[model samples]
Target chain A: MTKKVATREAYGRALAELGKKNSAVVVLDADLSKSTKTADFAKVFPDRFFNMGVAEQNLMGTAAGLAAAGKIAFASTFAVFAAGRAFDQIRNSVAYNRLNVKIAATHAGITVGEDGGSHQAIEDIALMRSLPNMTVFVPADEAETAGAVEAAAQMNGPVYIRLGRAGVPPIHGEGFRFETGKAVVVREGRDAAVIATGIMVTVALEAAVTLAKEGIEVRIISMHTIKPLDVKTIVSAARETGALVTAEEHSVIGGLGGAVSEAVCENHPVPLKRLGIQDEFGESGKPDELLVKFGLTAAAIAGAVREVVKRKG
Target chain B: MENSEKELAVLKAAANEIRQDIIRMLGTAGSGHPGGSLSAADIVTALYFKFLRIDPENPKNPDRDRFILSKGHAAPVLYSALAQRGYFKREELLTLRKLGSRLQGHPDMKKLPGVDMSTGSLGQGLSAANGMALAGRLDSKDYRVYVLLGDGETQEGQVWEAAMASAHYRLDNLTAFLDHNRLQIDGPIEEVMSPEPLADKWRAFGWDVQVIDGHDMNQILQAVERALTVKGKPQMIVAETVKGKGVSFMENQAGWHGSTPNQEQTEKALAELLANKL
Candidate 1:
């Protein structure tokens, strides 16, 4: 069994390490420091951590202000609140002004579990990606989350990193480098390509293994950066492989599926099937149950791959 | 330290000129919120020419005091003050709200120099100001942050959230001025959505509260002086001002909240402002 770690835990540890290296880095949370894992940084750097109460709007605005004053502010909150509630503040104060504020929103997608539909931010990717001057990242595992956090700190603009509540298996081995706006092809095959992000990357790998048993070779690509997407990797995947399957833990409308389709349709049209929540809201359930019910399991990706491959023929 | 009579006369003249410029800019744009702009003229004037330690040449100086117009519809006043302070050429003031103009309808910090924070949305500036204040403390900088909010803007819940954080964090370097003109766009602030007992609200929020006449330059300057002496808490100055002050027809009238005067009314308004010059 592979070791598992939640992306938010990786984010908290990465932030604390980053704070030790860069004194200019400051952390702010909307009274969810304990949950958002910003409390880790607060413990290390008591003077640099700011809990802005329960006001998401104030949290975002304050982060922008801190960024303007030569500080790299990492603001944490639930994805629903950070991307949905305080969107205007992020758009106007942070993105419009091009401030150096990183919004590390956690508990994204249906995996938030039991908290119900209101807590699940199925459209956070769409919201952050639509904003100009915002770099949207959805890391697949703990290693990628840590790398993305460091990369976001080095960059001088607004970044939104979506983190999950559920633990995910580490796919990368020793010395796996991460770069912004670049996609990593984990498994290479020619029969078909499965493009995935976040926890779905692990699912795609499992689906590839299951498909190999049936004499079907499938490729898997982990598209971590959603905005400034590695169009070259996606286009090549569509060109080399005749069929494609896109998967995510978000809505099929405007998340990874929408982004991939828009890129593929414009560059190279192929027999593509997007496997995600079918434009529906998530309900209260266990994380694994919700994943299975929402058709986000490895079996679902394999099924989509089979359908797309059949269409390719 | 009180301002000498000569300095007070100069500040009064500057405030009157800023009011005149606000009228000219709004009249040229043919539309804008003149009531709030004119009401905040003296406060803006005192900050720009008297209180704030800012250099127009080095607008982005690290240690310079920061000012945010939380009541951003009053861009004319901030623009006029910036122009008069040599942040930009005075001729550019006439191009306000025009096509491709840096002086936008609201304060855009990215577009214009000397704007510390981009604020058009009400109830958000106080938080940004608080952030700057926090950063100042963390860096051990003595730079103060000032924010101006409209009385009607206090109705937003985020304002109070920022208020709570400002005090909770013990930000002694931050000062907020509430442009208590008592009039909003719809009607009187009391009828629209009263944020009355305003002083008590700030006091309860753990700020050093001071209530002064908004249009009084001497009182405005003195309150700032006293606020600077305060330590370990944020300061709030509740300024009592008449909406559309200096123009007889517009004073205390909600109808002039966002309406621009026509060419004839412009001349009449400018004449009234110039006639009352100190």
Candidate 2:
């Protein structure tokens, strides 16, 4: 059974908790407080939060300054603005310096339904992961997201946490340790492994159930940290299961699929099929409608898994 | 006046040693940016030895004042200061730019202890510094944040965006030093891009701006102290300097921007820098 929780709400709760424990933890947002779910944290700890209008670059720069001053800063904004508008600042200021700045980018992927492709941040994982000293996290659901947030507060360097705006199925529970370079095997299987990240983890689990009914054993691995990738788990999974299928709510190119492929190729080569957006722009639609239109559903994962199995033969 | 005279002599000696380290490290690596490193040596020396309350033995000390080299290509100067301050062995300076060496051409915070921010690309350091400053205010920490900017880097629009934000936030704890050497990798800054009336521009942006000779120890220290005195506004010390300052052959030469001095040039440059010690 897939647990369901909202990632945005989890972020707010986790941040409020972090604020209480770590006095050095400060939060900054760029206008969209309620939507990004930082408003709750603001209301609880008003003194630590700063609403920096819509200037994402300024938000990033200020976060860097805060980090330099021995404060752990969590700069919140929509994924698109935080990753796209402030790429250079994030790269040069925060990443380059290796400051202890946390970039909480909400509204990631096609899950950002009605707002359309402009607000959706599908490329953020790749943009952030490519930088040096950047620890990238895309939690599977609310519980995992909360754990990742707390872990980021503890990590002594820069972290970029991708949070989805819409509600997601809960994947982890309390007491589940979210290690930076470890992947969680959500389900044990044998014939094929369905490696998934972010919101797609639940969809992959659903796909595994359907595949199991068809007598095809499916292994579901939740790959949360994109950079400092869980190469050991991925390589072991690839070696154990001759076929590999990667699913993500991001561009197929430089995302989870690419990361998995890089690990597999370098270690254990296997018949692989990547399940993600096939280099296409997301359009404005309902969240469910967009997931279907973009082939990011459980059906798509099942299809890709079947295809990889066939290719293995 | 006596105290000022004593501090000036120490600063001058420290600056000369930093410059000597920069040349020696670059000459050893055979591939490092000598120009900007040389130009920023005095400022880097003064910041580490004089201004910043850093414990070389305990670099990760929470209360320590932060200093970030925004123009990170000048890693030699930063590395020199860090090594001299005993953050690491001075012998490690020779490993600059070598494969597997911690002393990369650009500062890497992971490898080095004292480097507050890793920098190489232009116009991004200020934002990180802004983040640090904002964090300080939130935590009510007394530690100040300092950043050094290249004049050529000011041409990057992000610098202006950061400047506007620093003022708006009233980040009084932040101080930015601009190495206004008036030159860049491509010819002169005037020819490549105009950042003229730099001090006035910063003032208009709501910062406490000061222009001084970057190589002058007293002026640099005075500007830094003045920045600390002013409250409710960020400070910009636009220090005019000569690229490749201490080395006569490399001074003011655009070709030295990213070029490694050859074996012969390295020897000559080292000799010139050593001569200035007397």
Candidate 3:
């Protein structure tokens, strides 16, 4: 049996470790410390932790202030509130100034489950990627989430990390290294390539395995960093595999699909199919039920790969 | 901590010069906020020249007191102060709002020297100041954090949120000044959106509130002293001021809130300021 850990849980443990190593690290939460998993950091470094009490705007601005004062501030809240509610504060105070603030937003995408569309943030990647100096990351699982947090701490500008509420299967092992703007190829194939991020990466891997049984080999690339995208790897995959399928747990409009399409269309135009929630809101259901309903399952990705391979001449 | 009569006269003269600089820069840029800039001239003057322990040569000193122009539309006032304090050449003040100028339309801390934070959007400066204050406490540093806010800007809900946090953290080292010019871009604040019973509001938010004449250098200096002696809570100095102060035609007028002065109007404003020399 494979071990499963929520990305947010990894974020909490990673932040506490960061706090221990770097005294300049401080954490802020907008009344969602327990859910966002920042409570772990709060327990260890009580003096360095600030509970901003349901004020997302103040949380972002205060984090920017702390960053300006030479402390690396990691502010956490639900993706909906952090990206939707306090966008202006993040844009003006953090990104525009290029402050060293990291916004670690958890409960991203349709995987938020039971909370429904109002709570899930399908457009967070779009909103964050549109900013001038923001670095966007959507880690695959627990290990990558930990690596991303440490990487954000070492970086010198604003970063937006999208985290999930559901536990994902750990893809990388104990010695896995993470680098920003670099995509890791989990599997190699020839017929087609599936570029995915977040929870969808593991799903893409399963789809590749399923496709391999049918004599259709597919490459699985985990394009974690959304902004400052690994265009080299994406373009290379487009060249190696004649067809491409992009998957994410977010809206198909401007998430991983849009990013891959933008790169491939300009550099190496290939037959492509995007897999995710089509431009619509998600409903209240179990996480698995939502994934199936939104066509985000492994079978759905395999179906996208088949269609794209057929369109490849 | 009182200033002598001679010192007061000098500070007043410097403030008048800053007011002239505001007009000159606005006239050169051909567009900028004048009303709030003019109103905040005296307060900024008192801070840069008298109170703040800042050295232009060492702008990023860790121990230096920090100032945030939360009401950032009044960038001209801050620019004039920075220039006068030798952060840059005083002649560079005229390059404000121009292409590729460090003196952006709003304060850009990354672009300009001696600026504590880049703040164009309203209601954010106070929170940034709170962070600085908290950092000071964490490091056991004695540097104070000062932020100036627009009276109209308090209409933003985030200001109250920051107010609550500052009090919750017991940030006694942070002091905020609300430039109560009573006017915004549209019209009078009372008619637009009332933040009235303002003193009680700050006091209720757990801040040591003080009301003073914003244009009075003596009163402004005295409030700073009083704020330092207070403990266990943050400070909010509510300063009553005219929208467009000093210039005869512009004073108390909302029309000058964001409009720039024409060349003739600029000459008249400068002459009016020059006439009030010590």
Candidate 4:
């Protein structure tokens, strides 16, 4: 079995390390410290951790306040609550002021498992990406989560880091560095490209492997930063591959798929297909089963790639 | 006793100037909220002139006290306060709500100095104040955080949420004022949505609550003094005020909530404020 780690776990570990390095770092959680994995940081730096009960609005607002006072504040909660419940605070207090606040939201997308539609934040990407001065991130695995967390701490404005509850296999080897606003090309190919984010990046990789046997030679690009989309890399991939498929564990409306769609249409028009939730909510089920049910598995991405490739020429 | 006459005289002068600035800014902008601005003038003037430990020369001094006008539509009052305190030139007050002006429709801390936070949407200031208070405790810094809120703004659920958190964290360094003008954009707060039993509500929410005349400089100073001695809990001073307190025709009228004063109305308001000067 492949070794796996939840992105949220990496975030917790990275945050603890960061707290040790930067005294200005402070963490606030809205009663989900255990699940969001911020408890790890709290255990190490109890004085800097604030548990604001179950109030997400206060959580973000308080985080903005700390940032205003020159502290790097990380406010964590489920994506639904962070992007939904406290959107006004995030928009006005954090984003409008461009405060140094990191909204490290976990349990994003349909893979929140048994939480059902109400808890699953299928629209979080659209909600956050729509805001001005908000840097949205859907980090795929441990390395990306850690890098994104560190980057958000250093950046001078509001950032939204979307982490997954389900464990994902490591995507990069040792010494892998994460750069802001840059897409990582996991594999190179000529026939088509699969641009993916979050858990869907792993699925896209698997899909590329299967397509390789089928002689499709699909390329895979892990787009970690949803906002400030790497248009250069995306346009280059579109020109080289001539066909593209976007896969995400979120709604295709405003997630990675939507972002890639806009980029490709504006700059380099290519045969493109979006593979993710079909404008619907998620139901209670195992993470894997939900992925398969929502057509977010390797086979679905593979199918999307094949369809896009056929449209080429 | 109350504040000394000489000290009150200085605050009264500053407040009278802010009220006049509010009238002039509103008259120049052709659109702004003077009702709440005039209502909050004395409290803000006292903070800017007497109480707040802030330096006009170095606005970003790390150790200086912080103040947030949480009820941000009253930006004229804050801008006037900042200008009068030399955070910016007093001439900039006339450019409020104009093109490319730092005096935005609401307070923008990023653009203007001495503004502790940017707040426009209601009910968010207390939480940000809580965060600053929390940061102060974390860093073992002695800087205090003060915020002013509108009475109608407390109708927002987040104010109550922040109140609970402030008490839970025992933020003695944080102080809040509710500008209980009892009027909002729609109508009287009681007729629209009553955040009634305001004192009881705050006390029940674990705050050291005080009710005072918001327009009285002496009362405002006294309230500030008592709130400092509060231990291990935040304080809320419920300030009862008229919507447009100083101007004769504008006082207690809901119609002035967001309306601009005409040139004649501006002259009249200015004369009244100038004559009322101590």
For model 3 the local lDDT of residue A122 reads: 95
RMSD of each: 1.2, 3.7, 0.8, 1.0
lDDT per residue as tens, model 4, A210-240: 9999899988999999988999999999999
TM-score of each prediction:
0.98, 0.86, 0.99, 0.99
Clashing residue pairs, candidate 4? none
In the predicted model 1, the residue pairs found to clash are: none
Question: lDDT for every model?
Answer: 0.94, 0.87, 0.94, 0.92
Using lDDT as the measure, name the better of candidate 1 and candidate 4: 1
Clashes of 2: 24
Q: Please give, as one word, the docking class of candidate 3.
A: high
lDDT of 4: 0.92
Each model's fnat?
0.83, 0.89, 0.80, 0.86
Model 3: residue A28 alpha-carbon error in angstroms? 0.4
Report per-candidate DockQ: 0.83, 0.52, 0.88, 0.90
Query: Candidate 2 overall Cα lDDT vs. reference?
Result: 0.87
Q: Is candidate 3 or 4 superior in DockQ?
A: 4
Using DockQ as the yardstick, the better of models 2 and 3 is 3
